[model samples]
Structure formats: structure tokens, C-alpha cells
Target: MNFFKNIIDKFAGKPVDWDELEEALIRSDIGVPMTLRILKTLRERDAWSWVTANDIAEVARDEIGRVLPINPPPIRPLPAHPKVILIVGVNGTGKTTSAAKLAHFFKTRRHTVLLAAADTFRAAAIEQLGVWAERIGVEMIRGQYNADPAALCYEAYEAADKHNVAFLICDTAGRLHTKSNLMGELAKVKRSLSKHDPNAPHEILLVVDATTGSNALAQAKQFHEAIGLTGLIVTKLDGSGKGGVVVAIQDELGIPTRFVGTGEKLENFAEFDGRDFVRNML
Candidate 1:
């Protein structure tokens, strides 16, 4: 709450500092629409004049939590083995790293897991995921450079079946939301995965860099429009990111954040908590 404390110090005992409060929030990366709504809500209260900055902070936290859903429905148990988790996002958002972290997360839970490097766009991606797979003591499958990613997904599923893996995480190539052709290719990949099981890619998780702020929300909207998103993995929150983007994404897209990347280490990731997120940001 240090950031909010600084703002409060500036406005302490000042007569009706509504503009300053709104400015502070907007600077914190809370979108304008949501910031205005929050201020309006606070102004409606009977004790608006008496509310302290800390009290306002609590109100913000509660409001964000209300819109952010925690513990969304889990991956349903199915007749098929190896629940498929497809992780997608733009390149630099740490999508590959998050995929590795997720693999580590599930492995620690004692779930037999495997990783598939469906990203043929770059050799480094395939190699990086392979290293993580080896370190996690889980097997992985990849294809030659520019190999058909959908074809690789099917082969990975077959390999997962042999290992009786409980979870198969697929790391796809990063794509710009502006590229309709790339989005179309993603649909083809989805259709290809279905060849193995009608519902193979049960979870389409979008990894986002929280530091991207409002732009991240735009990307989420575009991606959701292209391929429905089941959940989100928000990254780069341990740095300069304000963490409000997660709330905004949830508010705009109705997609719950499933996990967050806090640091560079494998253990720096964890499931999303609305209270913890807001408290850390404030």
C-alpha cells in the first residue's frame, strides 16, 4: 500500500481532492472507465467525506475482488488421459517461461505431465522448453524448424498417452493480435488438435505481461475474439506493472486469471489471488 500511502499523504486533509485521487488511480494503470466507476461508487456513499485514503484503498480492493473471480472451475475429469493445456500469447510476454512454470506447478502437485513445443517459429523456443522439460524430469515432444505445429500436437498427445501423463502443456508460437492470417493459422492448430480427441485443447490459456497495461487489455479482447480464452496467466507483475490490468482484463473479457508470474525463478509463479494482487499494488 506504499503507493497509495504516498498519494494519501499528498491529499491529506485537503478539501475534496477527487481529481487528485482519480489521477493517482489512473497513474497506477487502472483504466479510465474503471477508475471513474470506482470514484463514482465512493462518492455515492453517505460517509464519503469522512472516508480516509486507507479506507478508499480498501474499497478499491473489495471492488476489484468482486469483479475478479478466484478458483474458477477446474479442468474437468474426462474419459481421456492427459488433460491438454494450450498456452498462448504474444512473444515477449514470457509465454514460454510461463509454460515451463506451469509444468513445474503441475509436476509438484504429483500430476504426470508432459510439454509439447508446438512453436516452430523459433528454434530457441523449442530448445528452451526442452531444457525445462528435462529439469522437471518430464518428457517433451517437438518438431523440426517450421514443421506443422498441429501435426506436432497430435504426436505429443500420442506420446503423452504412452506415459499416462495427466497434463500436456502446449507452447504455441507468439502472434500479433493484428495479424488476421496468424489468428486464422491458430484456428487451424485448434482444429488439428481435435483430431486426437474431440475436446483435446480443453484449456486455452492466454499469457499476458501485466506491465503492458491497457494495451494488454486490447490484446486480450482481440485474442478472445479469435480463439475463446478459458483463463489467463499474467506475467511481469513483480516489476513495474501495477497489476490493475488483470482486473481490467477480467472486467472486459469475463476471463479469470488462473496464474501469475512474479519473478524469473521457476517457483516465482503461483495461482492468482485478487486480495494479494490488490494489496501488493496499493
Candidate 2:
């Protein structure tokens, strides 16, 4: 973090070394295309050889600001049926925790919310989400371990609709993005929900670790391609300062980060704000 400060510290009062600057930008996890763009912009300046680190940081910030949406539309409820939100991610990305926090977020807004513990691949996942549900005072629908997640989600949707819930958050099983078999299972979940309403899963949010840096972009790409991600829920952002994937994902894949998880507590989560993110990038 302190992205700009790092740049200034390394090259201040010294002629900017192009190779070093390129490495720094790339190392920040902003992606190769963004790094090249920043370099190109600096090289186009009148005094290219005399460019300072401050100038580099300023241009990098400007470019990132342009790429990120200033205000991504907030997640809202469907007028008639439950607004389904499918949460997906690979292992150790805090997928289940984010689902609970998201449910808490909607509940605090006075919206009736329901939780679906569809991560039946692991017994502990079900128990974990169940604990969060009890702590948050929300109803959860869960299935037996080693159950079919797609079928479980379909049943959850039916219950949510019957209860007239405003939101139905499904915490899905974590799997590697590269596994076609696992990706196909997610597609099945989408198909199952679509049976109720053409757009039942209104939001397919991918939970990514901010600390994962550029690898997060690859996850986004694969998941977006498989099930069509509507947005992202970036996790573990507190004190990591490695939030560059938020910019890179948007810049490369055009996927806006909808929310961010900064800590373990539910209160640590918040909707992503482009202006605040850009300001903090410095």
C-alpha cells in the first residue's frame, strides 16, 4: 500500500529508471496492460527522461480512477420474488464468511434475508455458516453433507419465495477455477435457479482475496467466463494494501468490485467506493 509513497521513495530526486518503474508498477498487481499504459503516458511527456516518481504515481492514479466505476449500482431486491445472490470462490478466500456478512448487510437495511448453506461438499462449511446464521438471527436452509449443491439451491429458492424473503444468499462450495467439472456444477446451479425466475440468481458475486493480487484477476476471468459474474466481493483488505486487483479486474475484465471485507467482524464489510479506493491507493 502507500502505492504512490513507495514510488516516490524509490525514484524521488533521481531520473526515473524506466525498467525499475515498470517492475514496480507490475509488482503492485495493477496488471501488465496498465503498467504499459502508465509507462507509455510518461514516455509521451515533453521531458520523458526527466520524469519524476511523483509524476509516475499521479498518472498511475489517474489511469486507475478512469478504469474503475465511480459508483457501481447497489444490489437491490426484486419487486416480486426473492433477489437471489450466489456466492462463489476458490478455497480459503473467505467465501462463507462473506456470505454471512452480506446477509447481515441486507438485514441491517431492514430487508428480509435468507441464507442457503449450499456448500455441502464440506461438513464443517455447513456448521460454520449455521453458526453465523444463528448469531445474525437469520433463517438458513441447509442439506446433508455430500449433497448435490445445485439441488439444494433449488430447494432453498423455493423456501425463500414461499417466505417472501427480500434476499436469498447462497454460499456455494469452493473449488479451483480451472476445474471444468466443478465449473459445470455451478452452471447447473444457475440453471436450477433460472427455473423459478429467468433471473433468479440476480447477482453471481465472486469472493476474491485482495491479498492474492493479480491471481484474483485470473480467478475472476475464469469464473466470469463459466457462470457470468455480476460483481465481486473482495476480502481481507484490512492492512494488506494489496487492493490493486480491484483496479486490474475492472481494467481488464470490466468487472466492478461490489463489496469489500476488511476484517473478520461482520461490521468490517462495506460497499466498494471507487473514489475512496483511488484516494487510498496513494
Candidate 3:
């Protein structure tokens, strides 16, 4: 998303355009409250000095850092034979794609990774994940179309032990958070994982598209409420989503982003860094 660019050229060293700056921040998806807070911080930081756009950028960077702490939350460590990461998200949020990227991320580091195509509600989803597993050179455990997802996950968890895979990432079906039945089934999937290993689903990462704006935030709330989310994997950053929903998620739900997808290529993904994100945002 194009945010906070070329606005600096609008001001020199004289009086700052407070109105324009406010508008820019709002457009950036910083929201009204955060925009006001950033403006207030700019004034207080250097009340008398000539406020430059850089000064405003500095305040924004610092404020973002405060809300999204530089220290990321600790996901469960590996070496459990089948360390499972339950991937969840809504439809069209690139949930399936992110799962493959995650497997690629881990496998590159020499960790034996396997994927579970637990999204059995759709034959297309199952086939899509299967294709990704093959392209990435990883084993995939998938169930029949319209099969019970929870039972499939249980089987995948058990198979991981025999395969001696270091990580077992389960790709769950994409469901709108507003749908109660689908959400409940997701809970069942999580429970099924625990039946094999009490702490089986070591990480439940929610994948969201950056372009969904506040809709992404809404999805995060309900999914998190249904099944406690360990972290987030924000995708489609190369699109129009300014990625401010990430900030909103952190500020409101306290869920930190673990990774971001900058493009469609497998190498487009990277581990999230608070400082780096803030710097580029402003």
C-alpha cells in the first residue's frame, strides 16, 4: 500500500501542514485515534522547533514501536518430532499459499517439514495444497473430499511421529469468522491435534491479506476468540493493503505478526521486524 510517500516534499522548514498530515495518516489506515496521537506526539516532541516531515515520521515510527513491541512473542520451540503449526484464516486471505511459504521457510533451515491438507470441505483447496507440497518438495497428508477435518488432523499428527518430521504444519479450511458452524469445526480440529500430543498445535498462526484493511482486523477478532491465536502471518503486502491492520491487530488483540508476504514468489516471505516495518511505513 502506498502510504506516507511524497508528502514530505509538500513541506519545507516553515509551518507544517497539520491538516494535510492528518489526512495522510488517516488514508494510511493509521485510524483517527492513532493519527491524532501521532500529531499530538509531533507537537510535544518539539513544540518550539520548526517541525519537519522527518520529525513527524520519527514520532510515527516511535509510536508504532511502542504499540508493537520489538520483542516478538515466543512460539513453542521445535524438536518435538512433529511440531504442529495450525494455520487459520478466512477465504481469499492466501491462507493456503502462506502455509506453503511457511513450509519452505522451515525446510530451507534444514527442518524436515510436512503439510496436512486439512481443508477437506473443498476439493480445490485440497488439490491446491497438494500441488504446493509437491513444488516445495515436502510430504503432504490429505483427507478425502468432504471428510472430517478433525479426524484428518489427528491422523496427520500420528503420522508425523512415524515419519520423524521436525515440523508438521496443518493447513485448515478457510472459513468466514461470522459463520458459527465453521468456526466451531475449527475448534474441533485444534482439539484433534491435542489428542495425539497434548501440546500438539504448538502455534496457531492466523493468515490475513494486507489488502483487506479493517475487514482483516474483524476476522482476527472472531477467529482469535474462537481459537486462541498464537501469532499472525500477514500476506499480500505487495497489494493495496497499507498493512496498518497489522498495527490495529496488535493494538487491540495483542497478537504479534510473525511473518509477512511481500510477493507471490516463495522467497518473498520474511520474518517480521518491528523497527523495519515502522521505518518503511513512514
List candidate 1 stretches off by more than 4 Å: 1-6, 46-51, 75-79, 239-241
lDDT of 1 by residue, 44-151 (tens): 762545656666776777777678665666654355587889989987999999999999998888778889999999758899999999988888898998998888
Top TM-score prediction, candidate number: 2
CA lDDT, candidate 3, residue 160: 84
* Per-residue lDDT value at 82 in model 1: 72
Task: Say which prediction, candidate 1 or candidate 3, comes out ahead on lDDT.
Answer: 3
| Per-prediction TM-score | 0.91, 0.97, 0.90
Deviation in angstroms for 169 in model 3? 0.8
Judged by whole-model lDDT over C-alpha atoms, candidate 1 comes out at 0.81
Q: Candidate 3, residues 63-91: lDDT per residue as tens digits?
A: 87888867586443466568889999988
Candidates' lDDT values, in order? 0.81, 0.91, 0.84
C-alpha-based local distance difference test score of model 2: 0.91
- Cα lDDT tens digits for candidate 2, 1-282: 465567768888888788888898888888899889989999888263578777877888889988999899999998889999999999999999999999999999999999999999965999999999999999999999999998999999999999999999999999999999999999999999999999868999999998999889999999999999999999988777588888889989999999999999989999999999888888
TM-score of 1: 0.91
